[model samples]
Target: MAESNKNGATARLRNYFLAGVLITAPISITFWLTWRVITFIDDRITPIIPPQWNPESYLPFGVPGLGLIVALVALTLIGFLAAGYLGRVTMRIGERIVARVPVIRSVYSWTKQVFETVLSQSSAAFREVVLIEYPRPGCWAVGFITGTTVGEVQRLTAATVYNVFVPATPNPTTGFLLFVPKEDVHHLDLTVEEGIKLVISGGIVVPDQANFEGAEVDAAAKAQVAAQSDRAENVEGNGRKRRRRKQTQEPRSPGFITRLRNYFFAGILVTAPIAITVWLAWEFVAFVDGTVTPYIPAPWNPETYLPFSIPGLGVVIVVLGLIMIGFLTAGFVGRSLVSASERLLARMPVIRSLYSAVKQIFETVLKEQSRAFREVILFEYPRKNCWALGFITGPAEGGIQELTPDDTVNVFLPTTPNPTSGFLLFLPRRETQILSMTVEEGIKMVVSGGIVTPPDREVGDAAEPEESTPAPLAKSG
Candidate 1:
């Protein structure tokens, strides 16, 4: 009991620390960045301000923090002005004048496009969350439907669909933009914000499944039938004996030490990759500084001017630095370095084994694989007689397909409550069933482990799934 209390106290302290970070970090960082940007702009534009008439000169306290206030007020006024016709005309005229400047025009135009996209309410830049198969088969991913397909590709394909962006794991801001057929792209019943939460959590923090009324009702109906059947069976005496046998064979939870050890291992799994990457980067930098800096050529030497060290000598150093370490690691020279490093490592057996094992694990996990994009399919998973979540990534490749006779498709039966980890099963298309809910709804059901389902009235309708983009599947379909 005493040990348990000590652990609980430590946990509470950690929780409070995390909570403090969650509440205060954003505001503090936002203010610091805003201050720095304001300072930079003030320094750049300071000379433009007339010396005698400067706002700072006239103020008694030297107009403390004036630049930030000015920037904020100017931005707010510009926003207000842009909302009106006359302001827009004035702004357009100013923009036209600014655009005439050669170097500044490109920067100004790019900034305008970014700002307009972020500020304008009508922009459909990131409107919907979608579940699209990416990277490999047996793995389905969450992506944002940025907008309906446009640009040259759409015109070429004659597609009426949109662009779905599958952001990389742990970083939803960067991912591939796939142009999927409208029919193939399944919209989620999740808000864009909620979908973001799900993706960021990597499927751990899932939306409640109870949100789907239809799925719940269907489950309850099935349960009622199952209960009635069980009652009838129990009356036959065989059921009691079967129950006794099954109860005796039930599995047990892991021992405390086993659970604790697994938890520690999981922590190492998450951090080891990042730690190795940082170590490699540091080693590369140190090696470059040690080996290359001496050969950089003495500043005052006669050959330094290349015909005299050469003009743009600084630029040459920068270029050499960029390529030197990279080239060293790629060819014969790189292999020589690796061999030497290994010899040094071998001198320390314990450290060598630990480093080698960690490096191998990182390499395996980080290596790019071609298996991410597999054939899409529909399947009912996680429950019996009740079809819920599915994945379309179960198709076999050339050699694999030839081995199977039945038209097989790969469907990953994702474990509900956590969709990230699941079983990849080869299922037949004919045996697989279609679902009334959209792809997003299915994911929600899976993430919630069948706790959420479509509303009852719509569940029975195979023809139409009400399409007002479902609330985030993560929130319970």
Candidate 2:
């Protein structure tokens, strides 16, 4: 009896261990991968930054993401400049200089074209999803309709052809581009987003056909498959008969294994964002600690005396130092010293520009927080019917408003993935639509490229129905 009881307990213990692994393994792996990437980037990028300019120079330890921040600011400044007429002319001249190098020019132009096509919002790349027979007649693949075959390729083909991109499993960014006849391409009843998710998941998570009712795309796909199957039968050359294709008729319901795989993926989906966020937060803390710790006298430093070092102790010290400085600056002596120092720096030829620019940026970001980015608005930009998300800086002041046809407001249109650089426009007040969402939410939406959407405000049912809903565009800015 005792032996049986022990066996049961052992079985229960094994199951509990398995359950614990199922819960914690994903979280652990995600954290490990994120740490690896952060350290990797830090190792490479930290050394590139100059010591005088780098925050790490003042600190005892290395700063993660400092190099990245510098690179970001530099790129954003370049982009902001590039939006102007002079910058375009300069860019052209720079391109011409680069074109002089044979190998380098070829690489530059090719890569530039690829980025422009992929990143440009106006391009119709990956807007439509289709299925095409790849590798052989028996095998099939998911592909995106990039566009029509242009110029030489179109002329060579007898029938209308399309540029279909067949992306590899788990990585949709890399793909094979093929020019297939329009009739040969099978249209799937799947949205481009769903198709991408399918490709990224390697066919584990399938979209339900029932959701898209009365869609003729599936019929077209079915006909195309039937024709291909018949063609395969007719093309048999040897005595051995080719097997009829199954799995082509209809997609089967996901079984137990598929469900378990999907659940595993869901765990990853939950863990990944959390892991990345934690890593970034830790990097920031470490960066601040590194920047502040070195300034502390060895006798006063806790880490110097203590057996175990404390993380974020430097952050606390730095915060206290800032408060002290602020308090001192409130007095006459501190103000006089700051002014005198600034005047001296302004007298220097090279240091003046850098000092002024940095000071201006700090003042704009810190002092003018209440005035800047007060409201989120949408206005027509680039062309009519096309709208852009912009933050309302304020009413157009000075000579700028005098020239406009109507009363205007200054709007700061931020660039996506990087919001530091963008176009500033004086838009007519009536043309812009004010949104109820907060500036923080708007910024999040812009930074995430519409992936992070702010929920709509609740409206009364008594109100009249609107004609159409406004959506944030998938543009670069």
Best by lDDT: 2
lDDT digits (tens) for residues 360-396 of candidate 1:
6566445575222222234333222212234555356
Report the alpha-carbon TM-score of model 2 versus the true structure. 0.46
Model 1 quality (TM-score): 0.35
Clashes of each: 33, 0
- Please state every model's RMSD to the true fold in angstroms: 21.1, 25.0
The number of the candidate with the highest TM-score is 2
For model 1, what is the C-alpha lDDT against the true structure? 0.52
Compute the lDDT of residue 126 as modeled in candidate 2: 58
- Residue-level lDDT of model 2, residues 1-477, one tens digit each, is 999999999999999999999999989989998778777767866788787877788989877666556544554555556556886797688778867976445435433433344444445555667766674554678877665544323444435666566677797765444556665566666778999989999989788965333123455655655565455545642212323233445547789765545444433333334345456557877999898888889999989979997888887998899999999999999999999999999899999999999886577556755456878876554444224468887788789988886988888887654567677889899988787667765665454333233445543222221111111111110
